[model samples]
Target: MKQVCLAILTALLALTVVSPASAQYIWLDKNNVKVYSDKAPPPDIPNNRVLKGPRGYKAKNIEVKYTDGTEPPAPEAKAASAPGTPKPPMTTAEKNAEFNKRRMEQAEKEKKAAQEEKNRQAKAENCERARAYHRALQTGQRISRTNASGGKDYMGDEERARETSKVEETLRECN
Candidate 1:
């Protein structure tokens, strides 16, 4: 009689071990808090945002909200999960790759900004040089340079006129 009773108890326990994936609902409310109940979650909650199924229903995807409502102070809001609940599945390698990608992008932006500053400085220097040349040409002083034969060659009318035009063009471009 004792053996028969033990066998029947074991059979009952075995029969009750498995439960169907129904009769429960798990979702996040507008406040980004998780709610678990036998009834359906709020209608504002999208189907994909449901964390668990109820009554033969399953969400096609599970999305964790990372922000408050839909308004943005940008990514200031963080996703809230229940204490002692399992966290999202993410591998270390994927996290490392993402970090490296952002680092590279930041470095690229710095490089481009530095290049623009360098170009701006170079333009300023060129403009200063052009202004100095224009001033010297307007002074009416006799300009001379070393000739190919190492003799001082004074400025002639035609050559002076040509140099004046070149300097004027440079001034225009720099200004």
Candidate 2:
């Protein structure tokens, strides 16, 4: 643990000492936000748009061009990115954003799974009720119910048929 802490302190000291000695590029991003980096801005960015660049590397040397107005770059370049131009390591803010994005995606997946389980349970319940009602109708026994006026009423043949059809529809949907 002592060695680990010492190593971390040394690394941090090295980084702080190295960073200030490096040349930095400054420009406004597409969102019109000022950005500072250790790399040059995109080639297409206007020379005037580049607020600053490495020492002895004048920003006015840039030439803006758009090929899309005529033709696109070869697919090979897009498929196999140019070699030796490795992407820079992610910054702290970028790492945090990526972590948040993954976390939100996982949450969304869990939410969807929970909803599907709830729907499945509801469907099973509906199927069970429909099956029970179908069994009762098939018995052909007189089915009675209390009317809205609190009087006992019996189901007629037409009412039974209508109910059977409705239950059949519900069964079909549940299945």
Candidate 3:
């Protein structure tokens, strides 16, 4: 009799646990207070929430109007110019010239940015080469800067040798 009752109770518990009866979520409200519910949160809620769902769930985007009581001062009207120092209104030619100058300045800035990007890429390539040289040196291979027949290049022999030594030191110490 006891075994039969235990089996029936276990079956009932399994049935109840098989599926969720309701979905629930917690969200914040306009005043930044947390709220919990078993259904879709109220539209008046300040922030959206994530709720457990069966495959698909819609996200709620809640916007709140909040204000801190600080306001900016109003703009003051400009004082009228003195009689001898009259203000000149901008003319069409002057405006066009100013616009063209600004456009040219922006183009120059963009060109400089592109040049800097190229320089960075070149530096990265050089670092890769340094790493390769270091690896070759570590594996007991002789790798010089270049053949002597390449002529006097921009990188002097002393500087190239110094750079390679630095790479070797870094590889030995760091790795």
Least well predicted 10-residue stretch by lDDT in candidate 1: 72-81
RMSD of each: 18.0, 12.6, 19.0
Alpha-carbon lDDT of model 3? 0.63
User: What does candidate 3's lDDT look like per residue over 82-143, in tens digits?
Assistant: 34333455799999999999999999999999999999887777767778876655565444
Q: Per-residue lDDT for 24-84 in model 2, tens only? A: 8898765567888888888656677688886686554443357667554564684367564
lDDT, candidate 1, at 16? 74
Top TM-score model: 2
| lDDT of residue 125 for candidate 2 | 87
Evaluated at residue 7, the lDDT of candidate 1 is: 100
TM-score of each: 0.49, 0.51, 0.37
Q: Is candidate 1 or candidate 3 better by lDDT?
A: 1
Candidate-wise lDDT, in order = 0.76, 0.83, 0.63
Alpha-carbon error at 153 in model 2, in Å? 1.2
lDDT of 1 at 135: 82
Clashes of each: 0, 0, 0
Query: Following a full C-alpha superposition, what root-mean-square deviation does model 3 have from the true structure?
Result: 19.0
Give candidate 1 misplaced runs (Cα > 4 Å).
Answer: 1-90
